[model samples]
Target chain A: MTTSIRLPKELKVRVSEAAGHAGISSHHFILQAIEEKTLKEELNTNFYEEAEKRYTQIIETGECVSWEEMRCYLESLQSVPNPIKPIARKLEFNVKN
Target chain B: MTTSIRLPKELKVRVSEAAGHAGISSHHFILQAIEEKTLKEELNTNFYEEAEKRYTQIIETGECVSWEEMRCYLESLQSVPNPIKPIARKLEFNVKN
Candidate 1:
């Protein structure tokens, strides 16, 4: 199918240059770029939505642990005099949760 | 410099496993992952805000072009009797915009 489009000039030059670099006609290059750009936008939209949902859940539940806290907790586990027992206990606790 | 935290058990095990897989002490692995996750979340928040602004602009201006339309337009350029001149003219037009 054929259609008319009115693109600003700079974009056309870019498409032409991209086509030259890729060893394809400008038409093919433009189509490919449009396809790739559209797919990326769609994927990003989904990712953002999912992340937003997870963020809201974290906020509501107050169950999300900060990275700093998690890090510090891990650090203390190492400094304990009987590190093996505590580490093992923590691992067992983690498995239960 | 130091703080106490209470994490559920499953996460602790996963961190330990990850640390083992990476050939690092669990303490170091947890610290690195925490740092990486924090940075990623911060970056993603900024990206989402920027993308939302751009999406709103496109909606407000009605200037967002569909991929299908763009693809078809590129295809038409190929079948044009005088393709080069039109492509050049369009590119110049784009530059002006």
Candidate 2:
């Protein structure tokens, strides 16, 4: 199938020059650009969605360890040849009601 | 400095259960989740921005090769021991004015 698009005289000049430098047809360059744009957008969208899913799970299960403890454990492991996984636990908040 | 947030009773129960399972404080779990969410979003944002930048350059320069030609060149390279970059060229459109 054939389609047509109108480019201003200035853009035409740029396209022609770019096509010449790339050693490819202006038609091919435009197509490649569109393809790449779509692919990247899709990938990024999917990545964010996956992150959200994980976040929901964490909220639902509340499974987590504090950064301070994790950091300390990691530091302690620096001296050991083989380090073991640090234990995780719930945060105790002193809620005043 | 310390900050406080209110979670519903149900959520609190979930967090405690999750914290117990993870062997870390509920506080840590929430922090880690937030950190991961933020990092992924930033990375994805940067990725899209980079893609847009490249696409803009492609448009400005009009430097591109057609998918058909690129695909053929890639296929041909499969049989070769050492492959060279295929030449690119501008597209010629039959414009009616």
Candidate 3:
């Protein structure tokens, strides 16, 4: 799939390397990646139709929110009519640490 | 669900705008978006555990291959031992055009 191209250049190189090491083409490698991503997203999501409707939007926007913040907001919705919603921001992973 | 925070800045503003329009917080808007995305991905993918294993890799790499390209590659795999796999490439969207 054109999946590999959607990936960062370094990742494309890694996928190719993985494919080459396994004696397969980069095409197969990307297919597996897309399938894997799809499955993972399904497991985390609660709504199917909603996802389908928003797929194009999500892709075009390339926007994402973390599960933790969404969960907290949802939990608050049940109790507070005017709940304090978390602001949308970037992941503070600080991966290097 | 620190999900909304994972979204891009523009998306964050849009979510907040939508939330304000609907008399809700941006948090709820983002939560819905994440759920929708998750469901959409699941429908497209065939495997589950493989997806879980690759989520991190996918996010970090940010690569994407189109479904059409991937499907062709897979079909070739069935017929050719050394299928001339499609090379991973960027989408020729040319959205403006």
Candidate 4:
């Protein structure tokens, strides 16, 4: 497909120079740049969405394992092939309600 | 410093249970979870900001190296101790204006 884009004179000079140095057409360079940018945006969106989902789940369940507990278990795995897994549980409070 | 947060009864139960399983206090677990989330968000922000800056530079300069050119150069580096760097340049058009 063909399309048109407007580049200021300065940009046109820059693109022409860059394309010459790279030994490829300006069209390919622009296409590659667009692809790189689009992919990164998609990846960023997915990362945030996944994090949000996990955040909500943690909030609703309140099921969490402390960093201290998990770290020790993880460290042990450095030496041991199959170390025991860390378990997550609830905390106690004084009040019934 | 100490702070207070309200968790629904069900979440309170879950937090207690999870903490028990992990052998840590509910407070520590919650704190760690919050820390983890905050760090990831900071990282995500930095990643996007860096990408945006690069994108703008490319647009203004129109100086880009094609993916095909770069990929081949990159692949060459896998076997050779060092490879020549790919150059970026501008493209030619029929019309002067």
**Residue-by-residue lDDT tens digits, candidate 2, B44-69:** 66688799997887688777677777
Docking class of predicted structure 3: incorrect
lDDT of each: 0.51, 0.58, 0.53, 0.60
Clashes of 3: 24
Please give the lDDT score at residue B75 for candidate 1. 84
Clashes of 4: 26
lDDT per residue (tens digit) for residues B1-97 in model 3? 0101233355445445555654655444433443343444444343654786666555666555668888988998988898766654444554784
Give per-residue CA lDDT, model 4, range B4-90, as digits (tens).
344446545655555555577755555444334334544666688799997887788887677878999999999988898888766
Residue-by-residue lDDT tens digits, candidate 3, A57-84: 5566655566887898899999989887
Looking at model 1 chain A, report the run of 10 residues with the lowest lDDT sum: A84-93
Top lDDT hit: 4
Q: What is the TM-score of chain A alone in each candidate?
A: 0.53, 0.59, 0.36, 0.66
Candidate 2 ranges beyond 4 A from true positions: A1-97, B65-97
Model no. 1, DockQ: 0.01
For each candidate, give its TM-score against the true structure: 0.31, 0.36, 0.22, 0.40
Expressed as tens digits, the lDDT of each residue in B10-96 for candidate 1 is 545654555555577655554443334334544666688799997887667655655555576678888876443222111112445
